[model samples]
Target: HISALKKGRFWITPDPYHKDDNIQIGREVKISCQVEAIPSEELTFSWFKNGRPLRSSERMVITQTDPDVSPGTTNLDIIDLKFTDFGTYTCVASLKGGGISDISIDVNISSSTVPPNLTVPQEKSPLVTREGDTIELQCQVTGKPKPIILWSRADKEVAMPDGAMQTESYDGILRIVNVSREMTGTYRCQTSQYNGFNVKPRDALVQLIVQYPPAVEPTFLEIRQGQGRSITMSCRVLRAYPTRVLTYEWRLGGKLLRTGQFDVQDSTEYTVSSLSRDSYGVYNCNIINEAGAGRCSFLVT
Candidate 1:
């Protein structure tokens, strides 16, 4: 209360409680305001809790009982004390001619109720996407005092493919732009802080899966000046979900190359030594993976 309130001078104080003043969690608490001012008819009352206006509902009721009383009066009844209900309550009385008076009181609740029941409704949804696609993983948390949500990803893979980026919103929303094959991993959303309360800290997880096609452009080993030296060529894919299981085949023109004319290296590379006139045509590499197959060709002279 400020001294300037003396002009209209309506003091606001918590009246005696029906029970004890010590309010417990999950229990109802009632407080009455005794207002003393110059004129009772012009006095208008409004209530606030923690700087926010308080409204009447099933959980709370605020109204004037008697208008003829010398000092205006307003009653506040809280049905149940939630964790968020433990805050300062204020009552302000204003007169028609710009005169104002206000007072605030604290409502302390017991910490033994429940430790914020937090849950994510959409945690079971799959966050799967194809390569070069936009992806969003949504998580909704419900709790009293509103739990703070934060998102984190496991370091298993990093998809900087073509400058892809990711972002998380205040409401536990994760967005990835230009999703790529290397972005697959596990992501989690959990609560951070809740004042000094002993919260149980809840969390949810989602699996991210990225799928892509095989690389269509394979590097070729440049053929040096003619010789009996061997020339090596490769057909490979940089990214695949089950990456190690790729199949590669080397073809000359439209027909498969003979094993005696070229040597196969792992699953992607092929070498053609002892240059014969038959190797002077176009050489094609066919690479196959779980997602799809791709091919690239190079003219050997």
Candidate 2:
């Protein structure tokens, strides 16, 4: 007799990524948050400071690690700590099935006027693109002393799989040419306080959502999951971008598989919840995103 299969869940690691520091205003600061979940790719992150949502800009920044890795991680950074930067910072990790977890810290930021005021123009909402298209993200940094501009990804490991692509303009604009689906992730606009003692450290963030209409149909393959006893039929749709906006549903031998038709793991990759000889059949995976709709069928037997 075979034991029953288990479902996935979400959780987080305890923190004080680093103890909060009491620093003078001209200085910079950093904080990190770590979270883990089975099939971690489904976890979405949101950061907060002093009870408010924090967005990337000259004064604030956030980034994440590849979820496919163990104990996926996220970060919170205050580029050039300002008087207004002092407060409690929080990191919230959420799952679509409804579970949520978070961690918080109190950062005692001291005051200083030596560092000039650092500010960045508002970041536009994320843009949609097809494979092989070029995208440009622009930001303007304004301050008393002209500051140096820099660019980085919120999730470097996942976004820049091919290493650094040097397309930065002298101004605060970043451009990508002949882009691939994997190049999608949040990009940051940052500035340097070259005024010797400095005035302030500032940064900003923008999101790039990539959408690839199915390059190839979905295919089924057997994968190892348990102690050599359990296995799954994996349905993968290649080159799907902006995966967060895509919807997935399953079918067997041309018949629609409802939510309760059987236990299943729904994601960019569809996995049959239970495995048995009886589970073999022609499987169809359906995906829909702004780019368009895609469907694929494969025999598991």
Give the candidate number with the greatest TM-score. 1
What does candidate 2's lDDT look like per residue over 1-301, in tens digits? Answer: 2221122212211122333323445555555555454446566667777778988776676778655563556656676656776666666666544544333333223343222233444545476577778776777755322334657777673434336632233466677787767767887766643321122346677777777765444444433443324333344456554445666667877677742221232344456666576556777766766677566666654
lDDT of 1 by residue, 165-280 (tens): 33334566677788866668787766544221223456777778786666655545434435455677766555455455566677988888633211233335567777776667
Regions of candidate 1 where Cα sits further than 4 Å from its true position: 1-128, 143-148, 154-171, 192-200, 212-218, 224-239, 253-265, 269-279, 291-297
Q: TM-score for every candidate vs. truth?
A: 0.46, 0.36
Candidate 1 local Cα displacement, residue 16, angstroms = 24
- Sliding window of 10 residues with minimal summed lDDT for model 2: 5-14
lDDT of 2 at 142: 53
Candidate achieving the largest lDDT: 1
